[model samples]
Target: MWDSLVLGTKPYKRYYEASLLTRYIPANSTVVTSNTDSEDLRSAVFKTADGEYTILLEAKAGTDKEVTFDFGGEPPVGKTFYKHVYQADVQLEGNAVIPSASGSFSTGAGSSFTDSDIDAEHNVIVYTTLPPQTQVEVTPLEPVVTAGQAQQLAASVIDNTGGVTWSVIGSGNGAVTAEGLYTAPAVDEEKLVAVKASSVQDPDSYGIALIRVQPAPAAGRADIPQFSLEYGKYAFTEALTITTATEGAEIRYTTDGSAPTLSSTLYTGPIFLTTGTKKITAAAFKGGLEPSANVFRLYKIGNVSAGPDGYDFLAYDGAEELSFTGTASIAYGADGLFFYKTLTGPVSTAGLFEDPNPASDDKRYYISTLIQDEEPAVTIYNAGFEMPVTSAYLTGPITNGWAFDYRSGVQKNGSAFAAAVAPQGTQTAFMISRSGITGELIQDINFREGEYELSFRMASRPSYGDILPFQVYFDDQLLGTYQPNPSGSFALVTTEGFTASAGYHTLRFSGIETPQESTVFIDDVRIRPKGSPPLPENPQPNPLPEEPELGPPLEELSNEGFEAPVLAAHRKGPFTESWYFNGYAGVHPNGSAFQPPPAPEGNQTAFLQSVSGGQGLIRQHLEFKEGTYNLTFQAAKRSTSGGRDHSFKVFVDDTQIGSFTTASTAFQPFVTESFTVSAGAHTIRFVGAAATQEATSFIDDVNLNRLDASE
Candidate 1:
């Protein structure tokens, strides 16, 4: 030890040495080792400048544990060269002693807050370190489970310090096992298990909980029912059943084939069924619960039935049916329906219509109902035999948009019914027949393959320049002239296209006479390649001649317009609402809602915005200006049958002024009238006036022009 400063030093009574320091040996390894009994070195200390004591020593520190030495007292404040040494006691009662520092447990990892794996057999200390004032929580929230099962659940506890014990709060198992993890009961059941843990080292380290339960997985459902039906046919239906079942099952169905809603009734009876396919489904539902999926399946019911035999095919069978009438209604029947008539003053020839010829081998014809001008109509269908038989075939006469005057048929191009005007009346029509060919250009069409005969009705007749002269073009080759010489039952005839391919081809029965029989009335025409059935008649029906058509529900007519809910019998109809709609034509339902393209000739509609004053006043709802307005409307006069002359007139006020008649021949403008409106709102109406001459007139496309207004 060395003392550098003795600030204003004053001598003490005991002469306390200024500083004393010395170093020499070891204890266990002899650091600062000194022999206390060594007499020869008793005076070996060299003198200091003022006799202050200072000694040098060696150090010996050994062992893996930390080594430390404590100074007995404070060192001199300003000492330059002083040293001290220590070691494990070499002679502490003859053994060394280890030293220790103030090492302790803490918030650091392994030293204190450590986490261990938790399992069925082992749960070591779980340490969650936190500041003294902080708190924490751990929870066991979501857990997974297997399919088709359920159980009770549990959660773990939590605390602040570290190692903790989790305890169950409710009724579930306390410990979570390796393979037997705790699960909560079903949601329908009451109690469940809850768990948590508390720390001991830091008192409030963390707290946590967990929960587990069975899952309510979605189930697989069976298929639902599917089908539709006609009223008179099947009395049975079907439904599908579900499996892996839950309770409170229900099933719903519809006869009209509409989809079932929740409010639909449940099926309870054993439904009857035929042999055709249909849809069926079953569902499961209870109060306040979501309905389970429907079990669906297709169930076949029955096949279509055939038509009856020997039924009458008359237009006015005295029954209220549209298509098949008299005796048994032919909704699905298919044969022999005829009506008897007699001789007439005038006849319809060179016009398209169906006629009964008992002169043929059979007396049956095929027919189907359709709608024309919104009125029920018919079409005779001859599925085969466009190939003419020399002696007999299956078609009637064809005309150029003009009616047959008697029983007119539905004219068509392909499957669609033909429109009235083919631009202009410039095309030809023929009366191709399968009866006897008494004249030339006619055919007997009832024989087997490889044979045909053609003839006409009357043999020879008076003729002018090029009268009744037309060539027969066979496979694009002119074969012979069409002339008749009325004769034998084993008729002689002419034909074309016998060497041509056998398929559907137009026979082109055309001739241009000098206004004398120019519209060829020649019949007996045919051609065939092979054998087939004796042939079925056309499906189009023969319209009644000037006859009344009584419809379903038996509607009657008198003179009063407001007396009944009749459509066409009234003085006026379709009112002012002439928009684009085909299903709304005339006063009848076109059977379907409006569709685009052909369904709506949106371009064709009428607006009766103008009329005469006294006959009809403008409805208060309509507004128009007063002026000398020029108005025009398009009119179509369909096939009509009643009396000799009938007028389809547009009435100005109450007086008839404008109209369309059979006289125009096709879709042509009829009459035009002018009316003066008294400045305010005025009304104009389109009316089909009833006349002494009976006829059916159909109005299709229409246009209205106002000299003063744009609309």
Candidate 2:
């Protein structure tokens, strides 16, 4: 058999073929009586090592012959015989030239097969019944375990009377006991480990389970140190204290601006700031824990100076005692020059600061006693809301020269709601109204008791309209009711001239809420003599909406009532089909925010809101024959608070045909000025505008109809 398979080629194929017979037949098997009926056939039977008989038959090259093998009653009745036939084909190439084998099954006391007219071939038929298969199944196919933890597993054996052996598949993955108990490796990193169970009866049959091992959690670090005094300029001495929140943690500090280290001075008591500026850095440390992040502060002591040109410069460092009224308090220490107020009712809070340096300057008396008289001028410190510089969205009472009431504070420009750039600096003071309660920013100044006007750059929140009107006050008297333009950009507003008493008087900008909530932004506030040249009024208005001329009309705006793009819920988009929307404009179902009024023609309406302080627009293009046309639509304000300032402009092509305000929550019809267009295509656009954030407009049933020549 070996020589026939080798066929003058490498012995690898011969060895492979021999192993197949020895694997199942066994070399010690004994031959038994086996014979074939045809003269051209030969057969022999052998008893396998497993006590079963196997028959081998050989066919000679000749005419087609049907051969039968006689088992002589040795094989059991109803026994299934497995037949394998091997034949050679010259047409095959490479490894394919080797004789190919085919298999089939037959059952009975005797087996018969037909051989076609071809080259001689051998057939091996086995009558032995196969033993039941041995299968091993590992329980918990996948498990998650923590590092250094142990998990117990189980293996079940089926169809065989044998047990299983347990083993690990990867090095350093983990270890497993013979009883299937797995212990995960003690690691700091996560890994996957495979545990396997192999059947002893059938070693080739095995089961595997994967385990995910997670690393242990880490320890926490020490807390950073806190300073007793806020970092800023001061005119007097200060006692500074440094402490940490971590229990039993020691604080190390450096006063020379260098980072604190373990070798730095241990903080035990308060450090005295007698004069000059000092930069302090501190960090906290505890046993067996990482050092905390460093905290730094700069304190300038005795740094107050006289202003040039007979002007007295004054600064509030939050340490001075000031008269505070209502619900207000000054925050000192690390919070740094902040005044806080809590609104419980309709009352307001304020703080008063009198001029500390009201005396005139005199020349050196050694020469000639000469006292110079200069024009009386009072400068408001931190007038631009630039003090307490911070990147935070909102900071407080701003004790650096101003006081706040209720929802009023200093806000970083562009931090909340994508506002326009500040008129003068990176920060602006803001007052908000909620639940009919308004906010105020107050500062007491020692005016020369003359006619004065208040000037400040004011803007409405971009997302909401300027629904809340604000007033300027000289003490308890109102100067004027100022309404911010719907445009989000800041505009220099100068209040009407008002008279003030000579002593210290309060300058307050208070908000007046009209049935809803709103917010106003104030920056660069100044109280100057009435005729003082008004701050150059260079208001930066929001750029006009760009309406690109679209291609000729695509089906004449089929969804005029916004009935298409039907949404199961409210959604924002640049919808398609007949209309195109830019920015925060989309179709909304009736009864939705801003669409409270039933749509004029359908259950849905189109809504638009300002986009990042700019106008939100929706437009459609249509071809028009040279003639006069009238455009009309239904508009309504959003049904929510702060929605009163909603308005929109209608444009035919590039020309603004009309501007309309949606002051009422109910849908109202609006007609644009009749327009004449040349034959061709033109665009109709509705641009939304608001004076405050959260303002929205709803529109529906838009139509453009040609007027009859007779009219």
Candidate 3:
């Protein structure tokens, strides 16, 4: 022990104590031992006044007190010593025990070593150490290369030596260079290649990268393949087949005149023209090749003959019956016109309006006279069976109790009385064939013991020119066996003075029982009382009367300006007002309502706001008797910006008949389109389809009027 002298006096005797100081010694190059205990000594940490440096110590526990540390790499050239000063967390009882003061040492040539002769304080001691990392990693662990292509590989190395070895693991898979450039096998390879990188200083540490080889694609053209098909008018019964000559190529087609792309429907077999005129487009595509050129073709079909014009009358208000001799009549709400021509013998009616421009067709409608039957009459659900065919391979039960039964002798895609095939003009019609296996359309009627007239229009499939024989039976009794001409023209077949029993009775129209070679199509069936000459009610006597004041032109139209039942004002957000809607969940009942501003010739306009990715609509249910009407409406986009635009699709009773889109910043003139509506209540919906969020649309000024296109 040593102590200072009291009162500034010299120490009684200079006490001597044993002290030890140690530090790391660096070598020209480091060669770490493989022994696991050597690693524990390599974890020693050291610090100097300037900064800190790592030192690896090697010593035997409890047996050796002096520690020797190795700092790999050559020391400074001319420096006499290396100064090291550091505090350390050297011991652990339950927690780490860090030294309060740093230790100091110097290591170099001619370094001094002292034993037992040192200062009483400032004791430096050696503790533990840690091993430095000496490993490398291969980047791009998995790389892809073409079968005959080359790719470069890279490695990241740390500590000891940065140099690495390059090699491939799989035989015949690939070759590698000294610089790590790997070339895939010239032939297509089905396996993967492993390339390795090993550290030169520590041969046991290594890294590996995986290489995958893919087969190269074949060379081919970049355009679509050409298809073969003729363009011309075709009969409704015509079956057309399209073909292509490209090998290993796929053909795609579209029937709606749209451009064909890779996602279009694939064409596999012959196509049968079942409906009206269509624009068929087709293209071909192959792997690694350009799509082929598109081929377009158009076809039109119409009825060969139509029935005579029928008398037209408008029943106004609640009139049960109306008599007229003219060719056309105008009617309003709860009123309609019936067209008919007095028949001297057999009367024929236009089966279906096949002409695309029906506004110019005069023989598409027929009405003999208005007859009010007390009971519900059996009417043909779809006169021409023009409803869409859900599936060609599956049968669909129709409304108003109409169904198709597979007639004998007709094969798959060739069934008699099949739906969707156009037999009358271009409109869809049910097929009826003359086979011994009888197929019939049966309907039960409640007849009040009266003489009734049953009439139906029939046409022969133009593909087959043979005559078709059919029989009509009432209550199991054969009424008549008639042979219809195979001219493709719709001709009326009538059987009158058939006595109907009271209560329910079945009326069966059967196909030919005896085998024949023809098929007939029937449409527009009507059952009513025989017509008679009109009886005059009463004649008024003429007397002197005073002239009345002139009034404004009579209001012959109903709701022509959409100016009834004024709608309330609407703004934005969760619209709630009149007009039915497809629904917006809890946000709004219909997603639109009536707005106050920007009305196109009206006090109010329907406003539709965007609802996420869905559509909004405003619809009205109108009570129309029966008439052909030309329709018109006005629409515009909202003033708000920065959102998707809105469009309109007009539907009548769930069928989309017309549509228009608007993107104007200001309101524009009315857009017009028309469709004929039969007598009944139908819902007309003006839908606003939003392309994105916050898109707004406006609509107003709706009009409907009787159309006299033939005149």
TM-score of each: 0.22, 0.29, 0.26
Winner of 1 and 2 under TM-score: 2
- Give the candidates in order of lDDT, highest first: 2, 3, 1
Query: Which 10-residue span in candidate 3 carries the lowest summed lDDT?
Result: 11-20
Clashes of each: 121, 11, 26
lDDT of 1 by residue, 537-593 (tens): 221222212212222221211111111222111112212221211111222111101
lDDT of 3 by residue, 410-503 (tens): 1122333332223221233343454445555665654455677776666566665355677878877887887656566556666755776655
The alpha-carbon root-mean-square deviation between model 1 and the true structure, to one decimal in Å, is 42.3
Ranking by TM-score: 2, 3, 1
For model 1, the run of ten residues with the poorest summed lDDT: 590-599
- Model 2 per-residue lDDT tens digits across residues 293-393: 77676665552211211111112334333222112112211111111222222222233323233342211100000112212245455576754444545
Relative to the true structure, candidate 3 reaches a TM of: 0.26
Q: Backbone clash tally for model 1?
A: 121
RMSD for all candidates, in order, please: 42.3, 37.6, 39.1
Q: On lDDT, who's better, 1 or 2? A: 2
